[model samples]
Target: MNIKKHAVITTVIFALNAPVWAGEASFIAELASTTLPQQAPVVASISTSNTYFMTSAPFSANSSAAITHQPQPDPAITLPQLIEKDWWGALAEITVVLVIGELLYKTGEESMKEDFDYEIEGNTGRYFVDRIVTTESWKLDDNEVGMNWGHAYAGALYHQAFRNYNFNYYESMLGNFLTSGIWEVFAEYKEVVSINDQIVTTFGGSVLGESFFQLSEMLDTKEGWVPATFAGVFNPSKTLRGWFSDDTANRFDRQQSTDQFDIYTGALYSTKDTADISTTTMLLGVKASIDSVQGQYDALSATPSLVELDMELGISAEGIEDWQLSSSLFLGGYTQEVKPTTGSRESWGHNWFIGPSMGIEYSSLGQEDEEDFFAAINVIGLSAGGEWQNADFNISVRGDIFGDFSMVKPFASKDYQASGGQFWGTKSVLWEGGYAYGLGHTAKLTLKQATENCY
Candidate 1:
């Protein structure tokens, strides 16, 4: 059966079986209450009369207390009361992703095997069963490097579509996995299932998807056209839904919140020295953060939601250039307050995050070479950081840790090397602090090491 039919049957079975399990406790409670002694009716009548007498009295100091003492009925048990059953939105999102994948495949965006032996026909059921039960060995395909990266981006878009329909973070993640799985198993039935595509699309997509979601949320709060336009681009599912249905727009309206937004642009200079050669590169960057503004009593209590973006363009003395981008979105955090005998109060907070981070480095010395070695790393993973802030001075110190699945490629002279396999590692560190006048600076150190052999 197709995914839709499977989902419908599963939901029906659950609906039929749910009442039996949920009604057991309720039935026993009602049975015990029904079997009480015959004098219970007389006692209940007397209690009700007393309650009525108290409530019917003229206004008095004790009158309010009488209402407080009244008995309330036990709440009824129902299917919705026992479980949250909002899977239709999720199912619709999955269907949309599947349909889009089929469209892309049919439009020549993807290639199929020459024999076309896996075509859906009288053997549709057997084909699905075979795909599910069979496991293929890991191997590399001939798709371009850009196509590989596009898979992660597609995954992120799929995730955003699910979120647009009000799915939670974990549910949205499963939607991405399902979308990728559908594309791998059935959309390209003639091609071999790719292990790399699965990992990058699901995990890396999560990092990018969450960041995009936060950015879209942040943009939605602004009243200007520029922000709204970008928000729609980042979250197309919501934009499209709004065009077709008013209820979808209303639902998203309820999700928007009042949050602070700030944007800053600056320049950075870094000097590198190796042996007798020294090189300097100039970077122009823009940084934006939402809901990260500090308050007077922020040291005591602060808003924990934050979405941050930093994008930079690096130019060497010789004019060779590269682009770098890093983004992070935090769902929630834990905070603690510290008080010292002679110093101001300090607040420390730690937050968990998922997002995309990418960096590129040039190999050759600058100022003369037309071509340089290109090394780039892309990863998506769980990240965490702790910050100590003193709202009195508006200063804070932070340290971050990253554990991720990474793809590293080294290229030169208009040719790029293919990524062999997925690698796992801790990639970078950032330490930053700022003063009242924004006179402070940030310092970051990155470490890259190979942990496993690849193709």
Candidate 2:
């Protein structure tokens, strides 16, 4: 068994959300929920990045640099404030993007040049009807990466359109529902609606989309150019239209949210390669999270309460070679907090939450001869993890364990479809979208660490 050690000297500055949930921890059984956007948060910054934060602020830590917030009530944002926006403009923005993408896909690609060559013996209406009739649960034609991760990225685009106009979560999802539905129903009129695309796009946009949109909001509440750029990258629509351009001051809910985010960058040395190709590389990562844990929560509701997304990219001298994206949304549940007994040694804040949750995680690394090693999608399952925090040095260690029914492709084999030929310069877009598909019941384990100024 070859051993690999990852040593990272990271400047985790932007969104402090290390792979592990921050000080937001309560008890495992009573821990996660969200606070609505009541009072808008205030922005503060320090050196390197936006490091200066007020004490008791959710973004602060026990150490001078890292801190946690205490829950409190503030103002209420009326529905009218949320609904007041140019909805039509947002819709058009989304439509234009989808239309152009599909048009280019069908008209531009050589393989898709025969895009409308459907097997129909009738006119357009009949072809449309028959196309709908023949659509299955999923379209197998698209590569696994596109279905699993790419569609979701596309979905985030739809979710952000409405969010840019100041739309709330459910409303943004409404937009996602409508936009993705249209794409399935008419956007790519010639090709049959891709059921998998519809589901992945909609759901991924709902979870990932909202996460990034809120991430934009979170970053906006901070004072710095670096955080500002990230805010734009996550929600380009809002960025293009000029951020917070109106009276909508309630976008960043610092008053009610129990979220803390930070940018992560590091280095790793590892030798677990099945093909004996040990490697070392630098890392850069960011996180999108909101209300992951709090004082009170109700799991009985179907609305989404918590969204936690963590990503880590490995960069070798050759370029980015490995990465991981893990996201989870609390379907619903309640929170239980065991506050530090009046004046105890600050070690008594215990909280926990139990509720339904849905998530998607994809990790691609290592290589077995000519084929690559991959793990993608945990369709349905439960995961448990633990975290440790230190107050003096402002250090945190987080570990994640996953077990579930998954859709995975084990390796490069003649048995499945080819998935890695599309190229972008020296690398391949095929790497972005991995190889074939298969089913398996698998389990995985991952560990990560973060500190105030560790490199």
Candidate 3:
């Protein structure tokens, strides 16, 4: 390995220096031939033919001192020949580099192996490591039929993976001609038994697109605006493995943990990965928040304040048959009435909502070795998402037209609320459009791989 590394380094150095060395040598040679002759020559022999001509010049001194004094061609110092004489310098430099690189590589490799081996052999004290591990998988979909906005999206899996305990954080994004969307961001945790592959506990949350969009619009300006979203989920996959009763199936359902509403704290425990399909999972957690809203109009202004708390019990099947589907029904309440300002048309009230969602994704097996294709769709409450993937590139489209959608907000003085009831009369307009100017509107890029593994 050390030798290979040295060779690679040497090759890189040579590649970088070849053109420079050649150009320098040529320049030096030209300067030597043209400039050196004008100056004193360090070394040159005058043949008898040139010497005789110099001595017979007209009006030349006839004294013995002048006749015997020989002017050797100014010592010839040609730069072109100097490079050849110094070629050994470059060789010596490369040799020294190779030697040092070999030593470092050997030392690093030994250190890495020794450390890993020592840890695995239980030399360290018995202590749990709460490290977040990540794995990557991708899918592609091409030539999808019937979809108006066909695009591709990539998904990432990050979580705390260990025996009897684990957690997850997921995100996705895709765009096409019609629209673009993101999965926002969410995290989930689980605990289960190792023997039966049973999930005993879980907790998670996700940010909703509508909420994200709305918040983004409130803080936008002339340029543009983003969205706002925050959501969470809870489930336990291992607790219902033993029974076929209705209680087991309902164990994973989303239900309020207590009468409290809108709380974001809770105690959670879970088991390890025991089976391929993580079906039996349970979650019990609290969700809560506080908010202040103010309104400004031409002649009226007022601010409103509110606070809320909620607790929920939920169960779900995280992974099933190359697919995952989950549902939850939660109930909660908010501050009944808090009037921060008198003359504002706002009220604080308690409301409960149950949201159910399902997602499905498909990709050809072993297709990654060569090329791959993939597609997926998901929906929860008033939001929806879909994607397509192919070998060369991926495109995706996501749009949510339900609930309170967020709008673009530029600077504080200039904002467009999605909830703004604006109308353009006498004509209809498309929400999105596209056109290609050259070669069907294509873009090409080149990627260079790192020579050293940094990760």
Candidate 4:
């Protein structure tokens, strides 16, 4: 093995070496309310509502109140899972990703400036062997575009396409694996297949993709020009295809019932040294939490128990200086509800939650070149929290600590002055770029309080 020795360790870094300033932690205070779903709570599920605050960017000060429902069990109520499929949409989208994507990519100047002669020597079978199981192996790609949100976004599109075709979550994921393999082997035949891309594209895409898919479904239930525009933006290809479905163009037939939906907006005024901005940033956010998760526990279906998204876009004189978005999907976990006792009746009630979660965070706070490592995919993590609800007011708290993975700029790179992603990405992608794949961690602390006069 012509293995070389270098000071930089390509393995995971389990230290707090992040560039975020500790003092830059933004204060969070919001006044919010949760509107319960119209339909009764499903069996095996409890009625729940909450609003949480976090010590993150886009700080605000407001009060909140949530009308919550207590837990109840129904032994007789049992529902069967529904399964659907649309093979044509999924198959066609895959074709677009490969055939059309390749065509468009070739038009770019950077993509045309390529080298490394690759061809099918000997026979086609031997070529397949060398590419898949032999010489043409996998390597960590060093490109900034494909390594971060780009490939994951592509994967998200694939996941939504499969889901829109009525494929369950696991089925969509299975399709994702197949789609990625096909793209790596068939689409980009010139370069060696990326082993990291295989994993990141499949799993990271699924986490990010499933979150967007569920949120898109939630938005589809709304009625307004704003909701429709946001929905179409979030799921563009799916929306366009839905309109042209069978050439019918029926826009209202895709509505799906959701358990809860809450939307809030705030304006954050930043001082100096706190953030990259000095002006006020308008903030808007939406959150959804569903209890009765449809389908079976086999996890082969496309329904997540709890899906919530928090996104903030900072618009100032610089025209959107900071943009941050985070999405979380709670797959599964065990909960032991400890009802309030005589001694702990005031604050501690039969209200608590703990579970494993999958999520993705895309943050471009300052400039792309200044802080590019903020976006990290939470491969897998744990989330646990509880609430204190009374007739007059409510207070809920949640804290999350997650291990993250991302394509971080190398601590030291040979090409320090490369401008734009193309400079370090083009010509060479495996090890010649300013960034490389690595692992990190993030911790969030949330607390929300409210006072309401409700009967």
- On lDDT, the leading prediction is 4
Candidate 1 lDDT by residue in tens digits, 365-397: 233222232212232122233333232322234
Name the runs in model 1 displaced over 4 angstroms. 1-86, 109-130, 137-142, 244-286, 290-306, 313-320, 331-334, 337-384, 390-392, 411-455
Q: What local lDDT score does residue 243 receive in model 4, on the 0 to 100 scale?
A: 81
Q: In model 2, which regions exceed 4 Å deviation? A: 1-80, 83-90, 114-121, 133-138, 144-148, 165-171, 295-303, 367-407, 412-434, 439-455
Cα misplacement distance, residue 382 of candidate 3 (Å): 11
Question: What are the lDDT scores of the predictions, listed in order?
Answer: 0.43, 0.51, 0.21, 0.53
Winner by lDDT between candidate 3 and candidate 2: 2
Clashes of 3: 70
Residue 348's lDDT in candidate 3: 20
Which residue pairs in candidate 4 collide?
30-62, 31-62, 31-63, 32-64, 86-165, 169-301, 169-302
For TM-score, the strongest prediction is: 4
At residue 294, candidate 2 shows an lDDT of 46
RMSD to truth, every model = 16.7, 12.1, 35.1, 11.7
Q: What is the lDDT of residue 308 in candidate 3?
A: 27
TM-score of 2: 0.66
Instruction: State the local distance difference test value for candidate 4.
Output: 0.53
Locate the minimum summed-lDDT window of 10 residues in model 4.
Answer: 25-34
lDDT of 2 by residue, 111-137 (tens): 653434344456878666555554332
Model 3: residues with Cα > 4 Å off, grouped in runs: 1-210, 213-281, 284-455
Going through the candidates in order, what is the number of backbone clashes in each?
0, 23, 70, 7
Error of 1 at 192 (Å): 2.3
* Ranking of all candidate structures by their TM-score, best first: 4, 2, 1, 3
